[model samples]
Target chain A: MRRNRALLILLAVAFGAAFLKAGSFPGVAAFVPAPATHIAATTAHVESRFASSKLHTQVHAASAIELKDGTVRAFWFSGSREGAADVTIHSAVFDPQLGRWGKETVVASRESTQHGLHRYVSKVGNPVPARTADGRLWLYYVTVSLGGWAGSSITAISSDDEGLSWSAPRRLITSPFANISTLVKGAPFLYADGTLGLPVYHESFSKFAELLRLDRHGTVIDKQRLAAGGQGSLQPVLLVQDAQRATVLTRYSGSEAPRRARTMSTQDGGQHWSAPVASALPNPDAALSAVVLADGRWLAALNNQQAGRDSLSLMLSADQGASWRVVQVLEDQRGQAAACEPRIDAALRQSDLAVAHAAPEVYAGYRDSARVKVQSGGACNFEFSYPYLIQTRAGDFHLLYTWNRVFIKHLHFDTAWIEQRLREAAP
Target chain B: MMAYTDLTGLAGVAFALGVMLSRLPLISRFAVARSWLVAGIMALALLPVSDLSLAGYVRGVSGDLSVTSLLLLGLTLLSRAHPQRQGLLLLVAGAALALYPAAMGLGSFDPYRLGYGGYAALAALLLLALWHWVRGNGLIVLGLALAVSAWALGGYESANLWDYLIDPWVAIHALFALGRAGLAALKRRGGAR
Candidate 1:
């Protein structure tokens, strides 16, 4: 009996020690590397546009790509509110030289998706378009049939005429269980062999990121879960370092305070991934975009503030992603010089909301209240979030994000502009 | 387009149905009938009926039961010979209680997350299987050994280790069986008094 008692006590100690060792979190510095010395020219020519119709009730999850003709085409979903049946995918094109956005047009509607898919689409969200190596534009968007966002499934449509027209939509077979709960957000990574790596996430039964490896024909051939079993990470944005290596930054979704973004990397292509680790950067639980610049510098546009979407900052990293420094404050609740400019023109023949049949008094009241708040040093928490960044062949950075949830704002800048901002901010 | 992983789960369900029917005294009279019935159910589950496959129907109802639940069903069916019924029920009950609450986010720690090659849960399961082996309960030990091997060979759709260990179905069933056992024990004590 005494021998058995001793064995039990020893086993208890061993189990306790094992539990303690399992609970420790991985350190961030081990995953983050050292900084590099030089970077690309930071000067930039800045341009902003309200790509969506200013009269729309709400707009979000905007994505863009530069066509072969050098025209910047962007798309986002808009309606009375998100998840509304009447919501439709709205798109617009910007001429870089003219610096003006054309009229927004309805590209993909709920009825059109239903006709193409042969199933009922309750609503649509997160439309991401990527131009393949052969100049074919592949647009992937999310459709919900049964439940909330967790019931989302991705559908693919191609544009041969560069956003002018599209092919019939086909659902990507991502999951065997009715192909539900998979959604795409980050830009697709186009490989040399015409294969595409789309970063998607599952929100049903599990909140984890997955990399869907698709054939050139948009068929899902393989899938690898990123940060599998980790609860708080999703919407992974890929930043390629080489042909076989890349870094994925995921948005943390858990209810933990002081939310920070999650990070993972792939070395042997997308077959295997390092376990996700918390990054040093603070996340306000909002979507952010990252891109590897021509000179190998990393650029990210994110809500730098810890707990609010009111401030969006463009940040640059020299040595991979080991460290990040704020390059420019794109928008902040405190103020942007552009925000102070008069919103209502002197010739007030009509208001932007008038086209939507919205109450002008209510619209004007909200607008006046916002203006008063800004002028009184109490700027309303107008959100500038869900940034999507892409680099054109000319090496210019094109960024699109939501503006106060009212319009999809596009910002164009150059590497020289980023360098100048970093220089000025440096002591 | 149904994948092979989705179709294979029905084999366990068909086998379970056969085992349940064979346990009845009237059905057990014909020995060969049980094997034939199990084979027929498995064949039907693999085929399409009225445009909908049997696997599709089962997936619709169960939403893809975990590999663990399927293994548990197999062990329960086989354990009638070895008769470690109480031990197996308690083991399943413990796993279910440990996993479901954390999976539902009742705590900060999720054992479901551990289903993804989690070391602690794997170690605990290994120890439990070893205990069953020492007690000469080969059915459950065989189940655990096969589950681990299937996980290593990528037998299931999900790469998660927890998916092969415990799911909500097995957890709920185990908890109910344990509750019933507790009630029976209390009744026996009252009758003796």
Candidate 2:
């Protein structure tokens, strides 16, 4: 009995150590290398009619691409609140030479749903756009039909002449539930074979992640799941190193403890995935955004606090996601709000702020605080919101998150800032 | 590295710690006290009844199946039964509790997955072993069979049957309750002698 008890103690210690080591939270360094010299460049410029309108509410999940004419065009969904009927896909263009953003244009609207979904839309969400290798830009967004968010479908539109005009919206029927299971989050990855791997998830009895492959023209080809059953892994973020191998990271939303960030790998070009294993990241049931940096590192923006969005941080991971070093507090509550203006000015001094000139017109929209009522169990309290990320060609990062229920605050920064901070940390 | 801070994971850690604490030599001497203490900690860890305000709609969704609540309710019923019957009753009750989550899901509702994290699986196995050690009380064994049936029949609409039928919280409650009943039976037998 004594020997048995001693063995149990040993086993318990070993188990505890293993769990702690697997999480790897305590000892990782939280600093990065600062740049030797800082040369600021205007990484992003927001030019949209919604920016100055009372109808302007929330701008979220934006994707930006630089056109052949040196014009940077950004596409994102703006609505009264996230996943609302007023939510529509909007766009603006930035002319690098002019150093200004141009007028905003509506790409997809609730009226567009009447043509595509064959039903009056109740809400729209999560617009993600990508510029194909052939220069055609494709936009993907979600539209709900009957029930709550679970009853949704993905729709796509293409712009051949950049942001000047777009193809009429069409539904991409990707799920067995007609369209209920498909929702896009991350920027669509253009596979080497020219197929688009759009990250999506199902909200049925089983909330699992899927990689929906589409043709270059935005036709659904094949679908694959990231994890099996109801482990609640959704919002898959693709980390592409090359064509043959890729890693898909997802957020865990099940009743499982530790609510980890689940990760799986694919070698056969995303046809199948290895079983998802837990990563050492903490997820408190909030959305996360990740982008692959030019240097092969990854930048992930997430709420660092255990519970609220009060402390949003930008973290850099040099070794895939095995470890992370903090880049900076992008939007912590403690920083001086006045510091924002100077920071913008300082960044602009080092970099040229791209702006575009467009013919101004009379933009008409209502600005009423409508007390909209929702069904019994849906999210009701309405407000504008934003949470999006995009990586520019010049190795800079552009982020857009909601600034209260007001305007969408756009932030632009580069590797130089990160390197500078890392150098400052060096003793 | 990723940072996680949810009670679900903490519950597993607490269960591991409770298991370690219960096996310690010094703590083992005060078996009843140790059992209650371990049960209390496990209950606190598993159910965020205290944080109901913060958990909001999710708390209402998960309901309550804490270790202390299950063990205390089981012991209260066993105290009224005959000594031999009390042990049988504890075993039966534990099996019911362990199997309840797996068969019914977390509560009588949501069952797409197991309700009580990974601990439920361990708990179920432990109860099954205890039922076997008791030489198989016919009714207790019948209860186990019924729990298994509930698990099988629950289906997609039934949540995951494994979690419904057997869970760690249920197993812990059963073992501790059975232990208490066995001690009571032994004392009665000794007195008669």
What is every candidate's C-alpha DockQ against the true complex, given to 2 decimals?
0.12, 0.02
lDDT of each: 0.68, 0.54
lDDT of 1 by residue, A1-427 (tens): 4544444444445444433433432211111121232444554667565667555367889998888888889989888778989888888998887877888888888777765654456788899997665778989999887778887888788999998999987666455334467888898877656567789887877687777766566655455667664467888999877766779998888767678888988786555678888776678878889988766788999988678787789998888788999998887654434434253221111223232244777556545533443344544346678999988767777899987667677778887787788889998
Model 2 chain B poorest 10 in a row by lDDT: B54-63
Show the lowest summed lDDT stretch of 10 residues, model 2 chain A: A25-34
Off by over 4 Å in 1: A1-43, A334-379, B1-193
- Would candidate 1 be rated incorrect, acceptable, medium or high by CAPRI criteria? incorrect
B52-122 per-residue lDDT for model 2 (tens digits): 22222221122222333233334443434533445444654655554433222122222222221233543
Q: What C-alpha lDDT does candidate 2 achieve relative to the native structure?
A: 0.54
Q: Interface RMSD value for candidate 1, one decimal?
A: 11.0
Q: Please write out the lDDT profile of model 2 over residues A1-427, one tens digit for every residue.
A: 4544443443334334423322331211111111223335643333222232234365566656667675667766777777777788777776555545677778888666534433345677777887775778888888776567777778777878876877766666453222355678766776655556688876665677777666555655455667775677778878775555677777677767776677888776554578888776666555677777666787887665444454566777889889877776655543335433343333222222221121222211211211111111333222222345666555555665543343444556567777765566556
